[model samples]
Structures are given as structure tokens and as C-alpha cells.
Target: MSGKSGASEISLKQSLRKIEYPSSAKDALNKIVDLICGRITSIKNMDLALDLMAEFVFLEIDRRGHKRGFPLTPLIELQLIELLYEYFNNMSNESARNTVFLSIFSGTTAIMRLGVLTKLVSVAIAIPSATILSSASAWMQQLGNTSQNSCKLAEGLIQDYFYFYNPNTSSINLVPSISPQFTANFLTAVTENYFNFTKRECIFPPKVLMESVTTWVSENPGLCIAAQQKQAVLPPGAIAMEATTPIAGLLRWTVLAPINKQDSQVYGDLHLALLNSIIEIPKVTPPKAIYAQHLTGPINPILSYVNDLRNKQELKLDQILNEDNLQLALDRYAQAIQVIYSVNAVYGHVDDLFHQLKLLPFNKLMSIVISTYKKNKVIIL
Candidate 1:
């Protein structure tokens, strides 16, 4: 692992040296693609190599102010999509397959994190062809099985669309307006492809899915909020339902059927904290009509699952309030609270759930919670 990390760092440094500012993003993209392909063949740790390459490309785009010049031409977008497909198709080992999948995800995530994924989305919409969207759908379908790794891949794609396409954020204004119907269709397809893999047996613990859902909700607040809206007109036989039902079921199984008392307490507390945090965030006025419709079927169900768990007798708050476990529990609770605050900050809101700390009976727990709140308060401000 260390060797792979070292090699990936060296490759990133060398590839970054090839990029120059105030250059065409088109040409820079080509060079980076070549770098990624070259490293894939020679490197034992293809995942790290791909991740670094994607990160480098994202950073370069930011540094070069390429948002306006980004090659969104159908040909360029199609070529990148084809390259991704070819890489996935050619992989023969688990390592290679995982590498390619995660690398693409990491790359997409990098752009999204940098708030540049919306640039690509605008460019994609400029072209008449649905080839890029269709190609991504096909690639996701090819992931083969539902597991923790596959879940991550699905989340990555979902994150890309939700963040870039979401209306609540300023990023949505960067592109030409897309019809609500078009948004619905795209989300339906994305959800369908994601659920296809999620239906398979999972090898990891159920907590993994819970954590994944939590992370998704935290990171993509606009998407989650939009999903809660009513989409009055979905195409017949749309798969938008997949988003909510499966996620709700997953949460139910994970929360209600905990593997043990200790696990249940930990998960139960986290769920409660997450629920409280979500509720504490002040709501904003809905985005305009065109951007209002979202495929957030999972949000309500996940909330219900958490509420149900909170009502159950098994969730004894006092059990987890003891001195030995109090610190860990407070840490987890604070982390959940942080996710809510982070989302709020992005969307122009300020609310905290420190009031929820009263649920704990122990004074030490309250003190820890107060201290944690103060620490995060400084960070958020």
C-alpha cells in the first residue's frame, strides 16, 4: 500500500508538471487522460493512480479558470465517456475493475467538490445528443453486483448528478435552464441504474448502508430536500420509486435489526442525532418551479425508519450514557450534527441542534456535547 501511494504521488507530480495555466482545457484534458491511461498499465495500484489523476485534472481546471472554456462539445464529452467505458470493459481483475470504477467516481467527486461539475453539466446539455448520459447509465449497469464497493460507486454517481443538477445551490444558475421533465427523466434513469446493483446480496455489515445513506444525505442536501418535493408528473413506469423504498428498507433492517445491543445503541444514537440535526436546520423557500421537482423518495422513508428506531424500547439512551462510552457517543453525535451544519452553511442558513443535547441524562455527556458544539461552532463560523 505504501509503495503504491509513493508511486501515485510521483505520477501525480509528473503529470501536473505537464499542465500549464491559461491553456485550453481541451488540450489539458487530453494530456491528463493520457497520463491516467499510461499509469493504469504500469502501476500496481491503479485506484490510487486514477484518483490522483482525477484530482490533478480538477485542480488544474480550477487554477486555469477553464469553466468558460471547458470543452463541452459533444465530441469531447463523448470521447471522455467512451474512454471510461473502454477502461471498464478492458479490466480483467477485481483490482483493475475497482480501480477504474473508483477513479472515475473520485474524478467526478473532485469536480463536484470544487463546484465545477455543473460546468460539465452545462456543456453536456448544450449538445443535442444524450450519448454521455446514456453511456454513464450503461457503465453503472455493468458494475455487476451490490456490495460495499459497488455502493460507493453508486453513491459517487448519485453525488455527481445531485450536486451539479440541484437547484438550491448557485451552481444551477451556471447552465441553461433544463425542464423539470428532463430532470425527472435523468434522475429516474440514474436511480434505476443505481438500484440495479443495490439489489444484490451485500457482503458488508448493514451499518455500511446506513452510513452511506447518512453521508449521501449530508453531502447532497439539495438533492435530499428536492426528493421530498412532489413530482406531479413522472413518465409511466419510472424508477424514481426505487430511491425511497429500497433505502427505507435498508435503514429499517439495519436499525431495527441490529446485530447486538452495543451495535444497536451506537447506531440508534447516531440515527437520533442525525434526525435531530436535520430537523434543526432552518428550511428555505423552495427553488423555482423548473428546479423544484426532485427524486428524493428515500428521504422520507429514511426519516421514518429513524423515528421508528427512536420509539423502540431497545434504544436505551442511558445505557450508552455511562462514563466509558460517553465520549465516543458524544463524538458520533457531534459528527452527525456537523453534517447538518455543513449543509446549512452551503445553502445560506444557520441553525444548530445543541438543544437536542438535553436528551442525555449524564452531566458529563452534556458537558462533552457542549464542548463539541463550541468546537464545531468555531469551525462553522
Candidate 2:
């Protein structure tokens, strides 16, 4: 859901004067963030308030286009956030900040204060191979050229956190601990060039804004963030919908648990039983997701047996999977994929599907795209 693109081209920032923040508006049409921030009901409301705040922010930014220069709007954003801190501390209600709000446009504003929604927006508007870092040096130079004071102000505010809070600093140094001035320079380039963002070009902020929630929990002193821990995940008469596809449960465990050739044998056998069970059922098959429920309850413990054998490297696995088990497992996995994947559409040239696939993977599965187009040749006709 929060994936990124492969490449993108930057362009000019939009010249439109008013930002169309999504749906809810926090303040009056003439209001700025500072005006209503102090009047918020409670921290719980403040958390819910972010959705509305995002609109105010976008609108204010949109309005700034008519001004003579960059506002270097650090004071503006900081004031809004500071208001948020007070709202959190004083709230009597039970809205959890971490669970409720992750910030507007996720990482879009990471050029400034981007939070989780930055990635969500990127996913929503994704174009392949899009990254903000690739051409940053030239981009920085362009920022220097914008020559607008308001743009400069926004840049200054934008870069400070990128300098400190950047999680992207794991290895490469894309952004040298930039100064507010340096950030201003970058923002100038962005707005002046009008951010020529291609479908592939997505802005990536260096951080995912999250508080150490456990710390928040401990520090809060009295109750918990979400309904004082009294909330239930499911109400009465609810059941978790069956999962049709493989979802990596835990990253570390998945990384450690690669499916290799040996495990494939065991994996193969389990699949067969599943397939056999499904084929025996009547005419119209159930949804793949619905079938998945059968996998967990009926087949999971069986697979868990193999999992243990594989993990402990028990010799018993060698005896069971080698002959009969392999055929059974392969049958099941194939059957499942067959039933599930068939529901999706497939279209391509009929003449040489194998050859085309051998030569070109689909764009959905690939970064670069190639298609043949007829052209006139100057060969002595």
C-alpha cells in the first residue's frame, strides 16, 4: 500500500493560488491555522483535527502563490504543531495520536513535515521510478534561483527536519545537514521549477512521523490512548475474513524463513491435500479468501508439523517429503493459484505469448517498458 515509484521528472510547482484541501475545512475561509488552533476542544479532538488541519495548510499554501515571495512558513507550521502539543497534554478524551493521525499527504510534505500519509499519497498517485533524491543537487541549485521570499521561507522550514529526523540517513548522504538557508534554496528551486513531477516522480520525505507510543503510554500516567485499552477489535458475531493470499506476518521471521528446495517438497505435499479438498467440492468454488480459512484451520497444523521439522532439521522430513509428499503439495498449490488467479483478466498478443513473456515482463511487473512502433526506413527503396 505504501510502495514507491522507480523514476520521475520534476516540474514547476502549481501556480494555482488556493489549495483544495480534501473535504473537511478546519477554519473559516479567511482563517489561518494560528487563529483556531488555540480553541481546540482536547487532544483527542486535536488528533481528529489533523484531517481538517491538512485542508487549512493546503489552502494557505495555495493562497501563498499570489504573494511576492516565499513565506519561509516555518513559524506557521511550528505554531500549528505547538498548538497540537498543548491539545494532546490537556485532552480528557481517549483518541490515540499514533492510531488516529499520521499527518497530511503522508510524505508529500516530507520536503517539510511529511508523516505516514506521505507514503499513502505517494502510493495513491504512484508513477514508477519516482524519487525526490535522484536529481537533488541540480534541484538544490534551482531552489537558489527561485528568488522568492515566501518560497525561501518554506524551504527553510522544510529542510530543518530533513537534516535531523531523516531515517534515510542509514547509509548514503543525499541531504548534507542542510541549513535553513540551504532548505530555502531547495524550496525556491521546487516552486520556481513548479515541481515538474512526472508520474514517476514522487516526493519522499526522510522520516515516518511516529511517536514512541510505548513512551506515550507510560508517560500519560492515568489511562491508555485508545479507549483506555477497553476497546475490542471485533464486536459480537464478527469473524475475521479469510485471507486469500500469502501475507508476510512478521518481517524478521519471514526473512529468516525462506522457502528453499527441501522445504518445497513438504510445501508441495500440503498444497495437494488442499487442492484435493477443493476439487471434491461442488460446482461453483468459493472465493479464494473464503477458501483460505480452510487452509488455516484444517491444513495449518499439518504444515506446522513440517515447519518444525524444517526448523529443527529433523531427519524424518527427508523420509516423508521425498516420494509421496512432493506430488501432493504441488497439486494443492497449483490448484489454488489456478482458481484464484483465473478470476483476474489477462490480455496480450496471441501469436507469441511465451516468446513475448520471455522477452518482456509486463509493466505491472517491470520498471522499463518497450513496445514496437512502425517507422519508415531510408534504405534504398
Candidate 3:
């Protein structure tokens, strides 16, 4: 084994050894395992580290027996799985939760930074005994730092898990996995915690993380391994095409759809102007429809903002939102979305933009408009 691979194995062993496995704890361990890995709970459960480890174990066992034609007697393997599950269950309750969460998150991050997941993935394919680690590594990749390498790893890993592609060998393997956002959340929280007391902005929950991942995958529409092997990278111009096209479509439809001749004033001319500004950037790919709903959802709060603004007739956005300035708050929220959309123009495909946009400077245009709005308390007349 390479030095790195040996270290990977040693780390995995150390992690497993950290939890106690008492003989009497088998029952509880088995229950938690079943719940986490075996479809016992369709709804609620914890993402305990032990649960992840057990999943790795059972998956490894099934993997070996399934493909290699090894005889894992159902009765014996089943009982072993059950017992192991119970052991992990009690392990979770041992006030070890604190130690476990930190260790798993931090360890996973280190493993990823060292590029260990690729080797772990290969081992899983060969022995099938390593499926546990292999699977965990997939989630582990998602939970890594948000650098260019990390984004590529997460995007490729997830596409591999969902679509099942072999990253190194350029082949396909079909296995299901977790949602992208959950993966991002784990990495983001842990990273933010680490950044505490630092002046550098936190990295988790990147404003464009999910959007960029999904958009790149959607626009390319190929298996993960193929892209990895070819080192396929798109130019920024193509990225811009993917980013704004959807928004352009939305804008075009709004224009052709005709003003509401009936309740004309409800949505009225203001939205038309907003939509027009958005559509002007022709190539922008709009957010995915589902996510777009989230971006636009804050708009609904503006109804109350509008009502309050009308009562107070105050257009000073900074002063208003700062002091129950509901309208300004909504605009600020919209402004954030607008910023994301504009930044999307650049990060549309480049990996490290996750950090770059956080540091995006030059708010000249936004500042000018905001200054005017605050000066006059512009309330759309």
C-alpha cells in the first residue's frame, strides 16, 4: 500500500476504536444500525458517527457477498449485522456524541484534503469489503472544504453516488445517496465553527454552492467518471450561457403573457420593470425552478413591508429596515439575491468562486441606487 493509503487505513481503524463496544450493548447498537442503514426509519433519525460506521460495515458485507459470490450465510450475516447495530446504538448514547461528531467531521475533512477518497473508492470496488468506507467517503467528500478541489470532489462524488460513476476508472456504478444541501450543511457548519475568531468569512453554506453544482451538472449532462477522466472544463462564456438562460426565459414569458387586464394593479408595472432588468442579461441561467421559489419567496414579505411603508411613507431603506424597516429588509434580501445572480456570471463554472464572491467588491451601482432610495425614501410613488 502507498504511504497515504496506509495512513488512511490507520485513521479509519482509529476512528472505529474510539467507540466502546460492550457485549451487552449489542441490542441497542443493532437498533440504531437498522434505523440508520436498514430502512427501519423512513422519517426521523440522527446522523451519528457510529451510524455512519455501521452503514459502512453492513454495506461492505453486502457488497462482498453480492458481487464476489462469497457465501455470506443469511442467518449468520443477518445476526452479525443486528448485533453490530445494537453495539453502535449504545455507543451513540455514551456522551460520546460530542467527541464523535467533531472527530468524524474533522477526520473526513483531513481525508479529503489529502485526496484519500479516490483510493478508498478503488478499494471499495475491488474488495467490496470496503463499501462502508467507500460510501462514507462519498458523504465525506461532500463535507470537505469549499475550495476548487472540494467542489469538484463533491460534485463528482454526488453525481457518482446518484448516477454511480467510477471516478478513477471512467465507468458507471449505480448507487443512491443524500441530497446536496444536507451534504453542504455538514461541511459548512463544521467549517464555520473552525473559523470562529478568524477575520476570514465563513465557508459553509456558500450562497452559490448548490446552484453552481446543479447547474454545471445539468448543462453538461454526462456521467461523473467521464468528465473526471477527460479533465473536461468549460469556458466561462459557456457557463454564462447556462446561468442566465432560464431567467431569460422567465422574463420573456412575463413580457409576452400580457398585463393582467383584470387585476392590473396587484402586480402592476413595478414587477414588469424588475423582470425587464433581469431579462436584459440574456444568457443568465435562472436558478433551478425549485430553488428559484426560495429566492423569490422573500418577495411575499414585501406585502407587509409595503403596507408599513405606505403608513409611514418612509423610503429611507437603511433607516427603515434598521428600525423595523420591513420594506428595506425585503429589498436588502432581494439585493442579496441580485448579487448572487450577478456573481453567477463569473462562478457559473469556475470552482473557487465560492470564496471569490464572498469577497466581491465594487458595489458602485447598488450603492448609487441605495443612496438615492434612502435620500428620497422612494416608495414607488
Candidate 4:
């Protein structure tokens, strides 16, 4: 199923990327949105439409870096919400719902690119919050098997669209034309709405929070860069697994390193816990993640070696994480994380997670617990 979805996604993105923008970027974007939204007949088609929208925006940004940002005119706003509404209304098709929601993440990344390029940043998404929230509520009421993925995606989409507070100026700089208090109140309302839905609170902090965290992580050599060491000989029939991103590199230490590596059941339990945490469900009734069980065996022994130096007290905190020792620990682990995340769909950029963790003065961890009503769970480091 995923293989077919991947092929379709690739084909759609390629088709869109190959188109030459003979006209202005705004005109091209308008035409593409119109064409894509007009063709939305089924839930699967929503993914294709979002893919086309994202790829065109990406291509525009690539061709002309920060030249002109696309404006979210009333027409385009209506078209986008209408397209999303189509998917939300027909979300009973579980497979299609899952596939299209993943596309929302990619679509969001494209919009965020536009957000950074624009001088008055909120031009990326100008849709009214009430329209989106009401549509979601209506969808939930109509469907018997309400798609939780839809809720997650919708909440994330709205949050990202309006996440434009500028901490440096102590004001809303994303859309300077609007009232700062209006934007702040809008965010507060959106946050409360989702808290009611998910039954846990998460702040849409200033965009500068993410920026500051990423920059700090990137600058710290010991934290971001992997260490150099002679490759260790793996046991017979074992292959290597490497971390793909700096964020994943950090997780290898903070989250994965301290675990009892010889235990597949422990990894399975960990995977299950993480899944339950994301879906905001009770731990005792957590959903099964068979993929994690399948991959944990190969990952165990290699991971056992990841903390050898630390176990011996030979390296400091940063020194242990600074090295690429977690290379074997990340690939399959990261893949498992992605699958579990997709299965029990949670919103927010995965990369932003590590930065948020870094933002804590003592590397404190924040857990959004379902048990907590209108509050976030904080774990001190």
C-alpha cells in the first residue's frame, strides 16, 4: 500500500516540478491551485493536489530565492479550505485519509518556506481559523469512525498557518498589517480548541523559539556533530544503521543510549510507549506496532555497544553524544519512529522536537500527557 502511495507521490511531484513557469510566480501558483483544487474528487486526489501545490511552491522558491512571496488572496484561501474540506468530509476511507494527511506535512513545509521569505510573514496562509475548526468539528460529528489523523493534521495545519509571533520585538511580526492582540487571541483560541480535542495542552510559542533552538544546536559542535571512530566489527550477518539528521543524532543519546540494549521487548515497550504518547491514549490500552518488534532484534547488540564508553564512565555527556557511536542505533530506530508516528498520526515537525528539548536550560524534557487536563507534562533532566 505504502509502495503504491510512494510511486504516486513521486509521479505527481515530478509532473509538477517539470512544468516551466513562463508567467509570474503568483500567476503560476494561482493556476496550479485552481487546477489541483478543481480536480479534487476523492480523498486520494487530495494528496495529489497537495503534492502539486507543494512542489510548485518549492520550485518557485528554488528558481527565485526570496524574490516575491505568494499572497493568500481570498480566492486562494477559499480554494485551499474547500479542498481540505473535501478530504475531511470523506475521511471514512482510512487508507486515503492516512496518505493525504502525510501529504499535509509536506504541504506545510512548502508553506513555511514561503513564510520565511515574506517580509510580513503570515502571507503563507490567511484562512480563517473558525472556518477550519468548524469544518473539522462537522466532520467528526458526521463520521462514525472519526479519523484521529484528520484531527492531528488539521490542528497542526492551523497552528503552523498562524504561528507567527516574533519574540524579539515582543509582538506579532508575521502579519504586521493585522493587530498583534488579534493574532495573539486567535492563537489562544486555536490552542484552547485543540486542547479540548486532544485533551492536552501544547503552546504555539513564538517562531523565534524554534529558530533559537535550531541555531543553538547547530552551533554546538559537541551536540550536533557526530564523533569520529574506527568502525567496530559487527557480529555475523549484522548491517550498519546511521543517523540521517542532527536531531536524530541527539535522540540517540538522550533517549536511546541509556536503554538496556539486549532487550528486544524493552525496545518494543519503548516503541509502544512512544506511540501511546503521540496518540494521547492510555498506556495500558496502547496500539500495537509490529514493525518495531521486527526491527528491534538487529538493532539490539549494536546499541549495546553505543553506551559502552558511558557505562565505563570514560566520556562526559557531550563527549558521548558527540561521537557517531549511535550510527547503528538510529537508522532502524528512526524508521520505526516514522512508522509508529504515521500509524498513530501526531502533528508537528519531528525535527522541531529536538530543538524544543534543547531550549530547556537543563535539557529538561516536556511530555504532553493525556492524563493532564489542559496542562503539559514536564520531565526535568
The best candidate by lDDT is 1
TM-score of each: 0.27, 0.23, 0.24, 0.24
lDDT of 3 by residue, 129-173 (tens): 222322233343333333344344444444443345433333212
In order, candidate lDDTs are 0.38, 0.28, 0.33, 0.34
User: Which residue segments of model 4 deviate by more than 4 Å?
Assistant: 1-24, 39-254, 257-381
| Model 2 alpha-carbon drift over 4 Å, by segment | 1-75, 95-248, 259-381
Candidate 3, 34: how far from true, in Å? 23
Question: lDDT order of candidates, best first?
Answer: 1, 4, 3, 2
lDDT of 1 by residue, 72-133 (tens): 45555455444444443444443334333334454344334322223233334443223333
> In model 1, how large is the Cα lDDT of residue 299?
27
Report lDDT (Cα) of residue 86, candidate 4.
Answer: 42
Off by over 4 Å in 3: 1-91, 94-98, 104-109, 112-156, 162-181, 186-368, 372-381
Candidate 2 structure quality by residue, lDDT tens digits, 142-258 = 222233332343344334333444534321122222222222233223332221222255232222211121122222221111111122122123232211111111111111112
Q: Which 10 consecutive positions of candidate 2 have the poorest summed lDDT?
A: 245-254
